[model samples]
Target: MTGICIQATHRRGGFDLDVQAGFSDGRVTAILGGSGAGKSTLLRLVAGLESLKTGRIHVGGRTWADAAAGLHLPPQKRSVGYVFQDYALFDHMSVAGNIAFGIKGSRKERGREASRWCERMHLDGLAERTPDTLSGGQRQRVALARALAPDPDILLLDEPFSAIDTHLKRKLTDDLKDVLRDRPRAVLMVTHALEEARTVADDIAVMAGGRVMRLGTASDVTDDPRAHEVAVLTGWRNLLAVGWMSGNRMGGAWGAVDLDHPAPVDAAWIGIRPERIRIESQPGAGLPAIIKSVRDFGPVREAECVLGCGATLTVHKAWDTPLPAPGTRVGLVLPGEHVRPLTEGRAMAAVDRCDARGRQARA
Candidate 1:
């Protein structure tokens, strides 16, 4: 009742979105998903840009939309601040003007508010500059300052960093993180990057195929993504479809995983992070694999290994470690604690399957 509650459904073309989620005040929730996951649509529904003809949308106990009562507030009427992917800054307006645009008050009051935001966002000297003269990061700060200027009850961000350069993201992320801290509002951010979500959001809601497959604290969702979709979205690059299972041993095309305990009865996939794999020179220490290739990536070294069953596994180690020669035989130790079992029917692994199909068609 003190934050935002959403139970909404919207259909367009062949896709349907049905989401029921709640965000507490002063917490930031990241909607993590790939393209077409309905992340943006959910944001639109919350901002009143999209209609919910049969569901409810509430912000701090204020009903923005209630289809049963045939009530849907327009976007302008809702206390929401939206930052679009493009930033949507008015090119003609100065930085100060943009930040003060949302505040409805006397000229002096608006100026005073704008100056405060400019200082808060570290855009103090650029107040008089137009949007075209600002850097991408500067423009982003401007957008954020504008959105927060009016102090709305809910903040909606759509791909806020998609357009930023990779090198600049770390600082901007820190800045945004600092801005959101202790802010008494429900902030909803949509992003496909797990690092961004984990670093910024208090909670993460994993979305796929138009629904939230998983939602929990950032650590809980990322550390052990139980669903295949959640695993994929949370940076589990190695997922093996189950070929067979008997007791604690589960065999797939990639090899067999011997769990320390009984496997989940409905397990359909096994996932492990590349960094979780340990390579041993002794053959009998663990599963036998042959190093196929090795690549140096400055801080990290990556190796592609093929198991005895011809399934490929990627292993990552520190760059300072001695690299294994290609074609060298090694034992891969997949610690039981790092292995994740993704249950059947709960995950929509359609993204990978569709990609594989497209690759086949292209070939």
Candidate 2:
């Protein structure tokens, strides 16, 4: 019940944005989508950079903006913090100076306050270094420390890890998550990386075409997805257009997937996460498939399978499992419980696709 509520609508040119979501108390809510999905726009509106033309925003019992009431607080008056993607630290200021810049106390008091953040962010040694002399990870740490210097009730981060080197991002993300978890404030982070959102956030909000398409816990959204578009966007590998599905049985490009539970009426697509796919050891136990390709990624092996039922699917297996090479014949099985219907009747028409064998199925 305690956290932030945001509702906004803004239309400019061909793109229109409408989002209604919340950041729960002591949790991180990630806004995930492709470019131009309005993730950054929502943050800007909450920070008072964008005009709130038709919505209300309330955080921790404070009304930041309510367009119907003709009230809007400037960013200076709002108790909020923002960490920009590009680490917008003053080029001339040292690390300590940047942290102290957000403090509102006298010069001496500000210096004392900044020292605490330096210790918290593990920047004690780098406090005297300017941004130009620091590495990408160090620069991001400075940006994070500055954002938290004032102890705002809500924190907004716009892809804070995008600029850091890939080798250093995990450590920096862990450092930032520790601070956010221990403090337990309302946080909204915008990132396009699904791995980042799964690793860093408690709740996930998926945006598409200027609207919030799905909102739920990370596991729930990533596991089933429950929609074709969401499943595809989240990197699901085995989504196929099916002609029809009903209780425990579905007929489509992959023939019939004997599900453990009843599927939703008028199903369009059937999907399973790549990790859930398994290579059957016994002959004739699963679907007959021809291996199309196998890709190795150090720890995991990805295999593309063309099912005898005409549909093609991808399966992920561990590197040590010893997979057959391309063009090998094998039996494939989709674990019944993991395979679920991905779409309702509305999207049935949008996903028509031909299986590998030229049989048409709804995508």
Candidate 3:
């Protein structure tokens, strides 16, 4: 295979992971999901840190793991670079020594390579410092530099930004993006942050409940996540149960929306992104609803509204827009093109409203 192909079933404790995904060279594929969704375990499976109960992993036409062939490569035997969530750097060694440990050359040559990475990772003067003396972002850079020092064929990152401060996350993410731009290798990153996955990855694999829920380009997956679990993970804040009401119309907890065409037969929920919802003050403008509350979030304002069915919907609007006071009557307009139909499944229970934390609550 020209790219990294993985078809693996792994069991660890109470969790079972069965995923099939492919990642192309020179591209970053983010395995995105919430905690306990099996994102990190999938990364470990690729790195040989976890054994596969069944299936195969082929990287660059070489079989790294194959249950059928009874072949499983050790971590050191596979050409892979891994940056753990903790940025596992040697506290006893200087930054230069830690990075040089991975290089296979002699002392002089290793020193020269380590110096090059220090400059590349913007640690030019800090190379002599120990990891304990460095900041979170600095330690992260050192971990990445050390991983890349060996020139591995694959790069694996597990929540690369979890340890960094909120103020420094964007800058560090941008720095990592610049580092991966021209590198010709398959990079698999595991993260729960949707924005980080969208910002740093060329492709995204949505992992949830120990399976790959969706896989495609970042835009494709984020723009039109058709599955219920996929939609919720990708920022679809309002998911209401719907039932056939009339021609071209479907009634749900949030009232009804008139679609251009008939609703899908299998659609059990109507999903709307918080930013896609529009509130109109006119009595008969659209679906009837009452403004419950509004909060300012700097760039945007979040408003909570209640429908006639007693269900609530969250709407995000530009901060500059006129803010509606609490208890005011308003109409919700779910644009046909912006509304998404979510399929029904055994694991997908009907969600009537979003909780205070902006998560769906099953009624």
Model 1, range 170-256, lDDT digits (tens) per residue? 888888899999688889999999889988899888998888887778988888788877888999887888888998888876667
Candidate 1 weakest ten by summed lDDT: 354-363
Candidate 3 lDDT, 143-201, residue by residue in tens: 99999999998999999999999999998899999998887988998999998998899
List of clashing residue pairs for candidate 3: none
Model 1 regions more than 4 Å off:
345-363
Q: Which RMSD does model 1 reach against the true structure?
A: 7.5
Local accuracy of candidate 2 as per-residue lDDT tens digits, 145-235: 8998998888999998899888887887787778788656788899998888888888887777777777778887788778776776677
Off by over 4 Å in 2: 281-284, 308-310, 344-363
State TM-scores per candidate. 0.91, 0.89, 0.91
How much lDDT does candidate 3 score? 0.84
lDDT against the true structure, per candidate, is 0.85, 0.79, 0.84
